[model samples]
Target: MPLILIIDDDPMIREMLITAFHQENYDVMGADNGKTALDIFRTEDVDVVITDIIMPDMEGIETIREFRKIKPDAKIIAFSGGGSLAPDGYLKIASSMGAQYTFQKPISIKVLSEAVKDLLGSCKKKL
Candidate 1:
């Protein structure tokens, strides 16, 4: 099964995604911050990462950059509720940092599920 890592400071959001992905038959892992997420990333063969842009202790942009360093071809999906700027602004930065997909807060679980399937499909094609 594919492994997905979800990083968000909001416990509700984290758990919500975890449950959704679990129902989709994906192995899921959750972290409250990018720092903890990265620790899991380093140890696990994570196929996709869904991260909040404005997290405490490392933030999404920096985490994306670090992920790229560790695995340049890593599949990443970034989301933000916005902080000091609109969610679009932060999502744009995440895209430039190598996030394959971006979403605003209050994302639809169906859309996220499709994005994960798409990324995983592309990963399979590359291999």
Candidate 2:
């Protein structure tokens, strides 16, 4: 089974993602902040990462950079509302940094699940 790491400061958001992924039968892990996410990334076998952009204790952009350093092929999906910058701006920057997909706030779980499935399928093809 593919392992997915979900990073978000909001407990509700984290739980939502976890539930969504679990329903799809994907093994899931949750982190309340970027720092914890990175630590989990270092120790666990995470195939995909779903991160919130405005997290404290490391921020999602920085976490993406570090994840790239540790695993250049990391599959990341970045999501955010409006932070200091607009959601589009932050998600754009995340895409450039290494995120494979982006979602705005109030994301549809079905869409997010399909995106992850598509991305994971692509990765599987490459391997």
Clashes of each: 0, 0
Tell me the tens digit of each residue's lDDT in model 1 across 1-127.
8999999999999999999999988899999998999899999999999999998879999999999999999999999999999999999999999999999989899999989988999775321
Per-model CA lDDT versus the true structure: 0.93, 0.91
Checking candidate 1 for backbone clashes, the offending pairs are none
Per-model TM-score on C-alpha atoms: 0.96, 0.95
What would the per-residue lDDT of candidate 2 be over residues 80-123, giving only the tens digit for each residue?
98787999999999999989999999989988887788788867
Quality of model 1 by C-alpha lDDT = 0.93
Please tell me which predicted candidate would have the highest lDDT against the true structure. 1
Give me the displacement of residue 75 in model 2, in angstroms: 0.5
Q: Which candidate is the best by TM-score?
A: 1
